[model samples]
Structures are given as structure tokens and as C-alpha cells.
Target: MTLDPEDSKLITLARAARARNEAAEGAAVRDETGRTYSATNIALESLTLSAVQVAAAMAVSSGARSLEAAALVTAGEGPSAADTAVTGELGAGALHVAGPDGVLRS
Candidate 1:
């Protein structure tokens, strides 16, 4: 499937985050203002957060009231229910799924 340039950019950012951090998953979100935030999954002893959760938190902390879209890069089947829930709470209309290789799945 064809993706918009902006959506493609999100995939690129997410893929890079996963590779750079060597994390299980990476996620990126575009805010209503066109700002983008990206993060990798956090699995520390004291804290565990999905990539999408981290990305959404970053956007919220940075004054993003709502999200336009979100992207998740993972080798797993797809984003988990919790991942999609976070994006939904932030008002994201779409959640793009991609593999670690940066191929868009949905």
C-alpha cells in the first residue's frame, strides 16, 4: 500500500529509533501541530513501557494536546491493545504498522 510522505517519514523515524536503541519496538507520533515524537520501548527493572506509550507521553509532555497519527515498528505481529489504546486516547486517527525493515503493514 502507498503511504503519504508524512506517514513514510514516521516509519523512517520509528525504524531508526529501534535500530539506534536496539529495542524490541519503536514508535513515532505526529501531533496536531505537525510536530513528531519518537521513542523506543523501555524495559528497565523499575519501569516498563511500550514504544508507543513513550512516544505518546513525549508528545503530551511537549504540549501536544492531540495526535494526528502514529506509527509503530516491530517484528511482532502488531501493536498490542495497550499501544492502540494510548494512540486512541491521544486522538490519533490512524496507527501505521511497520516491520523492523521499515515495510508498512497497515
Candidate 2:
């Protein structure tokens, strides 16, 4: 499938970010004021490109189609780690993009 210019740009940016991280030898974070940073920050930025790709593909192919059907057949089936990631707790029921109430408590 052909990629839109914006999507292409995002992918290029993602690749560049990956390359930069690799070049830094995975030094994705540094201590500045007795704080811990994470490579995940960069990784998440890079991940946005891929997510956009998925969204674009869905919009085009799923035209006039039911999202539920798409979810069942086209969308990758899996449990979302959102809950675990947000709650800092594992083995939770009903994987979701947000916590049980759709708000990530800080």
C-alpha cells in the first residue's frame, strides 16, 4: 500500500529516532537532577508513526464497514497493556487503552 506523505514523513522520523538511539548505544536517558529518564520516551515518539499508519490503513480499507467487524477480523487481536502500564499493576481484567474509568490517576 502506498503511504501518504505525512505518514511517510512520520515513518522517516521514527527511523531517524531509532537510528539516533542506536548510535547513542541505547543511552536514551541521562541523569540531570537525581532523576531517572527512560528510553521509552523516545520509543513512544517513534511508535506514533506506526500507530498513524494503522489508523490510515483502517480509515481507507474500512470505508462503509462496521468497526466491530474490522476489529474482529482486521484489527490485531490482543489485550491492551494500558491498564497494567498505568496502574503499575499486572494481571488485571479487561485490557484497555485507559484505566477502568478511562482516567489515568497521577
Candidate 3:
């Protein structure tokens, strides 16, 4: 798979967030204005959230009205339904999935 520079950058940011948090997953998203948000999964005794959701929330909180693209770096199968929903609501055509090594998955 070929990634544009922006997508590649998103993957890099997601991977770095995962490594820094030592979490199960990491995700990044770019807003309509080209600002980016990245985050690792949030896990707690009472609540758990996927990295994609957290990244989306960050973008919303930061005043982004629409999404340009989204990427998730994980060992799991693919983006979850909730992840897809968030991207969809923000106007992303699709969610990009990549492995920890930065390889785009099928």
C-alpha cells in the first residue's frame, strides 16, 4: 500500500504514542484545517477507550469541525466499529490501518 506523506506522518505519530504509553493501540487523526491529534488507548479499572476514540475526542475538543483522515497503528485485526463511526461522522472516507513497523495492512 502506498501512503501519502500526511498518512505516513499520522502512522509515525500513532506509533510513537503507542511506544511512549506502552499501550495496546495508538491512533492519529487530521482535521479539516490539517491540525493533527494523536493518542494511545485509555484503560482504567472502570473504563476503557480505544486510541481512535481518544484521538477523535482530542480533535473535537480542540475545535476541529471535520476530519481529513485518520490512521490507527495496532496489532489487532483492524479499526473497531466505534472507530469507524467517529471517522465517518467527521467526514473521513476511510480509516487507515498500519502495523507497528509502519507497514500498511490489507
What's the residue-level lDDT of 99 in candidate 1?
94
Model 1 worst lDDT run, 10 consecutive residues: 84-93
Residue lDDT tens for model 2, 7-32 = 23333433343345452211111111
Superposed model 1: Cα runs more than 4 Å off: none
Clashing pairs in 2: none
Q: How many clashes show up per model?
A: 0, 0, 0
C-alpha positional error of residue 87 in candidate 2 after TM-score superposition, expressed in Å:
18
Regarding lDDT, does 2 or 3 come out ahead? 3
Error of 1 at 104 (Å): 1.2
lDDT order of candidates, best first? 1, 3, 2
- Please report the candidate that would top lDDT against the real structure: 1
Residues 2-63 of candidate 1 have per-residue lDDT tens digits of 98999899999999999999999999999999999999999999999999999999999999
Winner by TM-score between candidate 2 and candidate 1? 1
- Candidate closer to the true structure by TM-score (higher is better), 2 or 3: 3
lDDT of each: 0.95, 0.24, 0.92
- Candidate no. 2 TM-score: 0.26
